[model samples]
Target: MSCSGMETVDELELVVERLMDAPVAAVWKAYTDHLNDWFCPPPWRAEVQVMELRAGGRALVTMYGPDGEVVPNDGVYLEVIPERKIVFTDAFQAGWKPAGPFMVGIFEFEPQGDKTLYRGRARHWTKDALEQHKTMGFEAGWGKVAEQWEAVAKRLA
Candidate 1:
């Protein structure tokens, strides 16, 4: 799962990587089964309404802010490799129906002895979309989520 020397197109992608102190299996389980526990940053919680792990399956989550703000994320899984990788996008809905796309999200869990190297990439369709995501606190927000995920994974270990 080493993406060493892979040149990133800054105009289209944003990434967050972390070396977690938990095994790949634990990390994967935490992500797949306990997503709502660590998906959003503090004061904001996520609810996994529908998370079908297979390709073309629905991946719907509703995020709730402490102040009562609600945001729903509706997408379909593009790829799923147990304990290894997950690729999803909003480009299509259930049954392969086309829809307005935002960005493709890729999450990788690489085994490293007793630890896991987690990489998350968000690829946007355009530079503008990428910029918009950056403006929306992609770095800090995702970074916090990564930390939260690591904590949950550690607990699973």
Candidate 2:
């Protein structure tokens, strides 16, 4: 809880970050793989439909709701720098085919000595979607996922 070291994102990018007591490589693997189904806490299965870890790759994630409902989160890989950065988006599907894009996800990993600094940013296209995501309890939801990510990362560490 030593947030005195916390860094703020500029107004342009709208990024949110958190520190995890795990190594960079381990944390990267957990996110790259389908750890969500096991690590993400209750009312959420954290299922991964597909994940291809390379440029032009695709990842299909379904966030399961409390009552067995599914929300599709599809993204294509834009940049991949091992143990450092991953940039992807549901802005378009495979083949750059447009499908009324909604959001962009950027994950940047910085080495914090033995620990890792994880930056999770989701930039929605509009204020309404951002608001809807907040209404959906993004802080709680993503925060849990980060907690889950930490567990997985620690195991790998």
> What TM-score quantifies how close candidate 2 is to the native fold?
0.85
Number of the predicted model whose lDDT against the real structure is largest: 1
lDDT at residue 13 of model 2 (Cα atoms):
37
The reply for model 1, stretches above 4 Å from the true place, is 1-9
Candidate 2: list runs displaced more than 4 Å. Answer: 1-13, 37-41
List the candidates' TM-scores in order.
Answer: 0.92, 0.85
lDDT of 1: 0.88
**Per-residue error at 93 for model 1, in Å?**
1.8
Error of 2 at 120 (Å): 0.6
**Backbone clash tally for model 1?**
0
Candidate 1 C-alpha lDDT tens digits along 13-122: 88888888889999998988899999999899999999999998999999999999999898899999999999999898788888889899999888999999888899
User: Please, what are the lDDT tens digits per residue for candidate 2 over residues 1-157?
Assistant: 1122222243223455678888888888787764674445686676788888788998777778788788887779888899998888888787887767666778789999878888777777777777676667666666677777877888888
TM-score of 1: 0.92
Error of 2 at 151 (Å): 1.0
Cα lDDT for residue 138, model 1? 84
